[model samples]
Every structure is written in C-alpha cells, then in structure tokens.
Target: MVQLYNNGAYLLNGTEIIEDNSEANAKLATKLGANVISKDEAATGTIAYGILEKHNTSGNMDKLKIKFDKLTSHDITFVGIIQTARASGLEKFPVPYVLTNCHNSLCAVGGTINEDDHMFGLTSAKKYGGIYVPPHQAVIHQYAREMLAGGGKMILGSDSHTRYGALGTMAMGEGGPELVKQLLSKTYDINMPKVVGVYLTGKPQKGVGPQDVALAIIGEVFANGYVNNKVMEFVGDGVANLSADFRIGIDVMTTETTCLSSIWKTDDTIKEFYEIHGRKEEYKELNPAHITYYDGMIYVDLSKIKPMIAMPFHPSNTYTIEELNANLMDILADCEKKALVSLGGAVDFKLRDKVRNGKLYVEQGIIAGCAGGGFENICEASDILNGASIGSDEFTLSVYPASTPIYMELVKNGCVAKLMGAGAIVKTAFCGPCFGAGDTPSHNAFSIRHSTRNFPNREGSKLQNGQISSVALMDARSIAATAANKGYLTAATDIDVEFTNPKYFFDQTIYENRVFDSKGVADSSVEIKFGPNIKDWPEMPGLTDNLLIKVVSEIHDPVTTTDELIPSGETSSYRSNPIGLAEFTLSRKDPEYVGKAKAVQAAEMARRENKSLQEALPEIDVIINKIKDNYSDVNNINTGIGSVIFAVKPGDGSAREQAASCQRVLGGWANIANEYATKRYRSNLINWGMLPFIIAKEELPFQNGDYLFIPEIKKAVEEKQSEMKAYVVGNSLKEFTLKLGELTDDERTIILKGCLINFYKG
Candidate 1:
C-alpha cells in the first residue's frame, strides 16, 4: 500500500520513481535535463512545508537544553503537571498556559474527585496567567481546534489525539514533561524529519465515512511501521474530492499510526472548516508544488475504500466487511487468540456470542469524539436512521457532537429530531464514552464506535478486578447500519442511503460569548482556588553523581497502553491531585505498584535525613559489605533508593500527564524500555526527571528486584554518552551497558533539577 525510497530518487515526467545513477553524465546535466522533481524544489525539502521547521531550541543536545512557546494540560492531568512543576520549583505560570477539563467531566469515580479537579483548574487559571475551560463546555480537541490553533503554529498537548491540521496548525500530543518545557520557556528540540506524500486519487464510495478511510490507512501503515516518526502530507487530485470534515476525521486518527505529525493540502475546504468554526483568519493556502517529490508515497484510490472494522486490541487489526462476513468464525476465533496475549486469561472475551442468525450483532454503537462527532458525520448518520427504530433489544445507540456548534448545527438541520425519532440518544460534546466514564456496557459486551482507540482497558473495563468489556472501530454509517439492524452487525454498503447535508451552519456565538481568552498574557496577583482534596507535590531529590535504582515492575506486553499506567473512567477525577491520584498508579498492573514504589521512596527520604547507610536499613549494610568483599574500588557510595520499571512497550493512549508524574511521586527514577509505545510517554518521563533508557530486548541486565548502579550517571547524561555501564551487585563486579536515546539539551537540566518542577525553580 505504501513504498519508501531511501535512495536519492527523483520523479520524472510526474509518473515514475527513478534513481539518479548515471555516473558518466554531468551532475548538473543529469539533474536538469530530465524534468526532474525533488522535495527541495517544492519547499523546505519536505512534503510538509511551513507546517514544520528546524528545532531551534536554545541549547545543545549534549547539554539537554530547550525552549518552547506555551504549555498546555487538561484537568484530568494538570494536578500532576503542577505538582511536578512545584517540586522542581514553580513560582507562577512562567508562560501562557491552558487548563481544560473534559476527560473527567463525568465525575463517575472516586466521589468528589472530578469536581475537585475542576475547582483546582479554575483556581490555577486565576493564580497563573493561564486560561481554564469549565466542565461540559467543550471537548479538548474541539476547544483547541477553535481558539488555540493557528496557521503554522505548533502546540504541545497531553492528549495523544492532539491534531488540528484542518485548521492549519501543526500540533503534537506528548506527555506532561514536554508541556513543562514550554512552561519553563524551554525549546523543543528534534532532528529534522522526513516527510511522505499521501496521494489520493479518487472519491470515497457512497455509505463510506471518514473513519472507514482512517481505519484503512491505519491498517496499511501501522503494523509495517511505514509512517512512524514521519510527517504525512496529503496531496494529489483526490485532495479536492473530500470535504473538510472528512479530512479532519482521517487526520485525527493518524496518531494511531504512530506518525510524528501530519498536514493536509489546504484549500477552500480548509477555509470552510475554519470559517465554520469561526476562525477563518487562521486559514492559509498550503500546497506542494506540481512537481514535488516525496520520500514515500501512499497511493489511495478513495473509490476502493469500503466500510471497515478494527478488531479488538489495536487500531490496526482491520478487515473489510466482505472479508469479515466470508470468514466470520475463523476471523473471530483468531481475534480470541490475539486477545490471549494481551488479556492473560483474565476473562473470556469474545464476539461470537453476538452472531445471531450468522450475522454478527453488536449490543451498542457510538458516533462521538474528535473522530466522529462532526456535524456532517452525525447528519449523515441521522439520514441513515431517519425513521428506522433501533428497537429495544440488547442493542442501543448514542451520539455526541464534538462541540456546542456541532450540536447546534445538528439541531438546526433536524438531524437530532431524526435521531430522536429513531430512539437514539443525542448527548452534548463530552469525551466520557470515549474513555469509559459513560455508556458502560455489561460484562463481555461488544461495541462498535467511531472513537480514537479500542485498547483493552480503553473500553473502561478493570480486568485485574475481574470485570471486562471490549470495543471495535467502525465508520459512522456502518455503526448506524448495525443499530438499524437492532444490533446485528451490518455493513452500511448493503443498504442504499443518501446523505443530506448542506454547507455547515457555524455558530461561534457560544465560544465568542463565553470562552476566556488572555492571548498569551500572564497576570499575577490573582487568588487561586484550591479544593480540599488538592494536595501539593511530593519532594524530589536532585541528580546524584552515581545512582542506584531497583526495578519494581516488569511488563512484557507488546504494547503497554497509558490506560494501564493510571487508568481512565472514574479515576480520571483525581488527575489534578498528585498524591491522591498516585493511589491508582498501576492499580490494574499488580494493584501493589503504589505501596511497593512508595516503600522504596521512603528510604530515599531517610537518606536525605543525614543518616548512615547502616542506620537507614540493616539489609543495606549486608548487601554493601558483601559487595566490598568482592570488589575494592567502589565504597562509601551515596545510597539513593528510587524505583524504576521496564516495559516492552509503554505509553499508548489519552495524553494524560498523571501517567508519568504518578510514577515520579512514587520515586520512579527511570524507565527502561525496549521501545516507547508513543512520543507522549517518553516526554512525560523526561518532564518528571526520569531517565528514558533503552536496552536490547533479550539482553535485559536487571530483573524486577535487581538493583542497577550506574556510576557518574548524571555526568553520562551531560556528556551525551550513549553507552551507560550499570553494575548489578552493590559492591561486586558484574556490569553491563544500557543505552539512553538522544536527549535534547534542556532535558539534561530537567533531570538534574529532579523534574520539570525544578527546571523552572531558578
């Protein structure tokens, strides 16, 4: 489906890929005579032009220096950001900031937690120069799509689906520490990246929706790592075939492909998107040259795209409706096997039970969030369900508009009436269902949704506690089709449905009349509000010359999702409170990571109290004495007891900061991973002052309980040293090397200061 050319290839006559390998020909002659086209000939030598630029951070990567524009976090995550910042020495909001409350709006879990986080957000907004959005006002991406995004602007957010390309913005979703860089006025440094061309050639088939296209592209690119860390620039003749809403749907889900960022060719469709959202001034024409060359190409024949579904466990496990129907039993049984690797025999998760009359039946269907809540998508779904009752069977249906304007448009167009007539409930713009706070199904329930993810716990199930549910991805049209069938999984293509949506009616009056916009200005002397449950950050220690850390948790899952780190649903309310929220860290992992990690942290506190190693713990002396007898060079070492963990892959869900900060509060010193699941998690680790280390998959030098001692660890970070030798024995001789990936300059100082909190202290 996609091909990348690593050699210096050129596009000749706009129809072929050729390497310039003729050595006998003159360099200039070979380059000029063939009507050659290269990336540099178009703009910036990248398929994505002004959307991205040089890193331009303040310091050297060798020194880990950085500087950033503004910082952003949401209520479900800000408490931890503030706590980490406070620990590292926060005074006032050093830069323009935004605190939005959307993830925890349901207030479903831990009574008083969600409301308390909201109060803390409002208070923090006042105390700092930041802006705060009250609960239910708007979903995070919708709010960003409106006021925060601008042409050629870069935004760093804590949510993994933080995309605003249709508005001409280049935004990245990372963990909280990355936001700390912006708050501390540090730059974001990254090596220049290569860009790929997503060349579209035809219009999508009738009854097919954006989610269908997104699922198609994700399936093709994800497993093979085709677009990982590369920018996807939409182009070609078919770019003009899709509407702005259609493009936005696909762009938002690109995060699932693990791409670094994305941009689309901007035209009237983009202008219409901004104009409908009341931000037309943010629009700019962004297009590649007629002869632009790409490092890679994805030739998408949109007409060939069809209704699709991503099986449980990942966004990439896809199959066409036709293929699925032909192999229902075999495909479903295969899904059960894959679930075993992830579910670990916790609960019997299956969809075959819903195969009524040999047609797969889903109990629920959802069309919501940044991916499916748009006016066009919902309006079309309403058209499909106009007078068809969904029936009061085991199957039910619900719809959520992405924002107030989208909701208002639906009401004005009679789409809401159409849906209501069909027995589908229409809700406001909230991300609750996407994260499992609302519309929870019974145990073993199978649902189809147009949301961003379907990770195991992402459906809001607590497998560790013996409760479980599952979700699958589908287009809005197909989800509606299944609902119209009274729960039997049905493909929309089987029915004839005509979409009736005119130009969208944008009602910006809601935001223009209510949203608080400071325009990047900071105001001091404001009295901040603090709820009783809101607690300050725990104390953190500065970097030591040599460090000893014990690995507390080891997970070998192919991909460790963020939902596993802190969880979503009811626990979301405590996101703004560090210590209170830490109580839930790894609650699903072993349900003992918090207390176990805290036990190790207490020893670090004792070490800072001017006590001898023997005085701190008798066991420590025994280990040290045994080490001294075997090796004579290492002695009298400053003992620092902090916990670290290892995972095959981690950080793959909502961009909540609490994931990394919770670990930091529990005394996490480092994370050793074979590879990080997403960019956000690693950034969170760096912001929390934790070392993001990498080691070979089979060469793990330390076990879960083994202590790893690294001499001159701080110096190694400062020196840009890739190979770090860590000893296993306290005083003995066994040692092996681990690696730390490339670090930006500001990153080193953040570690030395103990976290992003201290990075801003001075």
Candidate 2:
C-alpha cells in the first residue's frame, strides 16, 4: 500500500509528481518555461520549508536557529525542564509555555508526589507566566491541537508525539532541554533537514482507520531509516478526502517513522477543525507552490490499505489483520523469536499460548491516549460495538477521550453510553496507557491497544519482576471489534457495521474551568513550590584534559529505547529528582548497571576530592599504570574517571532527556554507539555533557569493565576534531579511533562546559 521513491521528485502544481530523472527534468523545465531550478530554490516552495523559514532566526538558510511560537510539556518533563531553566538564571518564560499533567496524573504512586507535581506546575505557571493543565484536563498533544496549534506556527513539546501538522502547524517533539533553550530565548540549532513528500492518492476503504494507514507507512520506513530526521510533508488528493481528525491520526504517528516533524496540505476540513475549536483565525490555506520539490517521496494508496496490526515489541512490526489471521501459527512463532531478542530471555514470552483453537485471543482492548482517544475514533469504536456486549470472561475494554471536551461531546452524543452499555469502561484524558504508567495487564496477558506505541514495558509489565505482558497496536475500530467478540481477535472489516461519524463539538468551557493560563503575565512575587521528592540536578564536572571511562554495560540490542535506558512506569515518580531517578537506570535492561556505574562514580568522586584513585579502587592503579607506560599524561589529576555504555543503536524511542541525563547523573561520561537512532537522543547526550562517540568497526575493541583512555579529550572537542584516539588499557593496550559526528559550535562548547547547565552558568 506504500511506495517509496528512491529519487527526488517535483510536484507540478500540487497535482502531479515528476521524478527528477533526466527525461522528467527536461519535461518539467519545458512545462515551467524555465531551466531546472536549484534544489534549494525548489525547496522554498514546499510547505515544510515555508514554515521553517518563518521560524528560522538565522539569516543563513543552511544553518537554522529556530525560535518556536510556543512550547509544551507534560508533568513527567515540565518539572525537569523548568528546574533546569531556573538553575540557568531563568527569570520568566520568554514564550508561551503550557505544562500539562497527564503522564504522572495517577497520584496512586509515590504517595501524593504526583499531585504535588501538579501543584508545583501550577505555581511555576503562576510565577513564570506559563499555562498549566491539571490532571484529567487533557493530554499534551490533544490540548495543543485544540488550542495551541495554528497555521505555519512551530511548537516544541517534550512528548515524542508532538505532531499537529494536519492543522498546518509544524510541531516537533524534542527533548526537554530543547524546550529549555526556547524558554531561555535561545534558538534551536540544526542543519537544514531534508523534506520528504508523503504523496497520498486513492481514498481509504471502509473500516480502515488512520492507524492502519500510519502503521503501513511506519512499517515501510522505520527499519530502513527512510525518513529518519526528515520532515514528512503530506500532499496529494487523499489529503482532501480524509477528515481533519483522520489526518491528525496519521500525522501523530509519523513520529514512529523517525521523521523530525510533519505538515500537510490544509483545506476546508482543517478550516472547519479550527472553526470547531473556536479558532477560525488560526486557519490558513497551506499548500505547496506550483513546482515544489522534495528530496524523496512516499506514495501511499489509501484504498489498498487493509485493517492493520502492529504485533508485539514494536510499531514497525506490522502485518495486515487478514495476513495475520491466515498465518497465525507462523506469525506467532516469529513474534516469539523477536521477543527473545527484545526481552533478552528475561521471561518466556509466548503469543502462541494466547492462540486458542487457531484463533488468537487478547485479554484487554484499550482505545486510549493521543493516538486513539480522538473523538472520531472513539465514536466509530462505539458505533462498531453498538448493541454488542464485551463478554465478562477474561476480557475487558476501556476507552479514554483525549480531552475533557471530547469526553463531554461523547457523553453528549451518547457514544459514552453506548460504550458503557457494551461493557467498556471510559476514563478521563491521561497518557498512562501510551507509556507504562497505567492499565497494566496481568502476567502473560496480551492487550490490543490503539495507543502510540507497543514497545517492551510500554504496556506496564515489569520484566524485572518477571511480570511480562504484550501489546499489539491496532486501530480503535478493530480493537472495539475484538472487544465485541469477547477478545477473540477480529478485524472491523470482517464485521459489517454502519459507522455513525458524529460531529465534534468543542467545549472551551471545560478548559476554561480547569486550565491555568497566565496570559503572558509573570508574577515574581509568587513562591515556587518544591515537594520533598523534587531535587536539583547534581553537580557535573567539565571535560578533563585526559579521560578514562569504564565500559560499565554492553548492550548488543540493535536498538535501545529511552524506556529501556531509564524505564517509565513507577520510576516516573522519581523523574523530578535526578539522582533519585538514576537509581533505576537500566534497571530492566541491565539490573547491575546502577551498581557498576556507582562504583565508577565513587572513583570519580575520589578524584574530585583530591583523593588517590588507587585508594578508591585499587584496580584503577593497574590500568592507570598500564596507560601511563604508553602515555605520560595519564594521571588522576588530569584524567577524569567515569563509565560508559556500548550499544549497537541507542535512543530509538522516547524524547525523554533522562535517557542520557540519567546516565550522566550516574557518572557516565560517554556513550559508544555505531549510530544513534534519533537526533533528540544524541542532543540529550550532548546537552548533558556526555561524549556521543561512534565506533565504525563491527567488532568491539573493548568489553565491559575495560577502561578506554582518551588523552586530550577536552582539547579534541574544543578543536572540533571529528576523529579521536582511544586506548583500551587492560591486559594489553589496544588503540582504536572513535568518531564524533558533525557538531555545531554551541554543541561543542556544551560538551566542554560539562552540560547545558554549566554552559549557561559560565
């Protein structure tokens, strides 16, 4: 259903695609009555380039220093972002900041710490002239869509699903430090990114929801890195066919394709969406110029898209419902094999056991979070399950409206009653299901969710506790169909049901009654609240002349997500405290990571205190002496001691800063990876003063506990040297080269200054 263009293409008047091949270029030049334009000039006509140009503060288009119109964060991230900004002499928010409490809204954990965070958010909003949305008020992105998004505006959010492109706004989900930069009135620095055209054509068949189209696109692009870090601009006839909500559903999931951000051609559908949300002025007609060019194109035929399912372990592991049902056993076996890789044999993960009499059965179905919680999805789900009962035998269903307004509308339209009558529970707006914070199923249970992700532990199973469950991502229609069938897997297309596509009525009063908006007014007299669990960041030392880092953990996993780096679930309660949350670093992936890192941290602490490294760790003297034999500058005073982790690919999933910050807090000085999965992850590492080193060779030069000594490491970063030499000092000194990818001057300085905090402090 999806076709990827390997070559550049031109959109002729936003109607036809002309590949940039020799013959096609000739025809296009003749049609335009002009010679072939420069790729840079052609790019200016694209919707993405237009939006980016509006936000770019730098005079040069090659190097963008972006200033977003607004910034957003949920509770899990806002506390840390604001805390970092405050430490860097932040007096007030320079731009509009919205802090939504949806991730950690469940106050059941940590005994009132969650609500305390909410209160802190409110007080910080008051003191800093920001906005705060209380618990159950709205999830981050939905609220942004309903209120914050506007045509051609750029918004930065801490949550990874921060995409509102369907509304003609270019929204990006980045690490909290990026937002911190925006709060400080600094620019988001990046090289000009490639823009990919997502050209959609034929209309979607009945019962195939937006999630199906999204999963199909994600499946095609994710593994191969087709759209990695590129802007995906949705264009073509199919854009006009889909409603605003459907377009949003597909747009939000573009984060799964590893794209930087997204925007789409807006029409009356989007104009109506703005009018419905009471922001008619925000609506603007946005489309590509007559001869816009894209670096690449992804042509999708919406008609051929089948009811889809992304099987357990990842959103990219996709299969159509028909294919999965036909080849059940084989697919189950393949999933089990993939589970072995993802789970590291921690628990016996079996989806085959869930299959009963050649039919797969799931324990629960959830249509929640930003992806599935939209009004149209929920209404269609309620329609599919109308007059049907979700049998009480080991099966349950739950629905969560994205915002209170959506919930109110559902209640008003009787969709909530239909869902409740069919034995489904409806909850308020919370992002717990998308992460691991809420709706944890029993051990070995399989849940089908219409959430954003299905990554390991994202379904709330603690592999450390030997409690493992699985989540398969599907559309809300199919999830509801499965629930109607009492959890036996069924696609919505198989069961013929008329959908009642009800109109969405925005209720601004719900937010007006609950949300705290500062209206751009800061009150310095207001006191900032600090809970007992909330703590400032630990002191970090700048890069030393010579550096020594122990390989504390070695992960061979092809990709490591942020959830595995620090985990989500109950550990989110400690996110406000750096050192407190660092205790859970690699808790699920490597249970001994904290202890091993702490041991190395002790040696670093000893070095900082002018104590002998030999006295702290006797083994360090042997390595130091061995390194001293080869190099004269390898001494405790000049060389700092820390730990590092080697992963094949790190920073795949969430934009959470703790992925790198947690490592930094636990005495990590560097990360060795073949490649980083996302830009946000590498930025997190740089912002936290960690060296993002890349080793080119397939064979590892060092093992866990081996010491790598890099002489003149500080000077290397300062000089913008791409290649640096490192020696593995143990039984024998083996030297290898590590490469640091292209870094901006500010990024290099951030590393030299220890971190963003230290950089600002100086």
The best candidate by lDDT is: 2
Which consecutive 10 residues in model 1 have the weakest lDDT in total? 58-67
> What TM-score goes with each of the models?
0.92, 0.99
- Put down candidate 2 lDDT per residue, 292-312, tens digits, no spaces: 889999999999999999998
For each candidate, the alpha-carbon lDDT, in order, equals 0.75, 0.93
Q: List the residue pairs that clash in candidate 2.
A: none
Candidate 2 TM-score to native: 0.99
* TM-score of structure candidate 1: 0.92
C-alpha RMSD for every candidate: 3.3, 0.9
RMSD of 2: 0.9
lDDT of each residue in 1-762, candidate 1, tens digit only: 233344343433333334435641354346567753443664354435444442344333222233434456677667766655555555667666778777777776667767887777776676666788777767888778766776666677777888876666677787766665566555566665566667777898888888998889999888667777777777667778998888888899999988877877678877877776677887787766545556667767788998999989889989988789889989999999999877878778787776777888887889988898877789888988988989988788999998887788778879999999999999987887788788888789998998998888777788887888889999899988888878877789888787786668777777767666555454567655667777777766777777767788888888888888888877777666677788898887657787778777766766777557566544566655655564445444454568888899888766676788889888899989998876667877887789998888786767787777777788898898987888786445478878988776777887877877666775
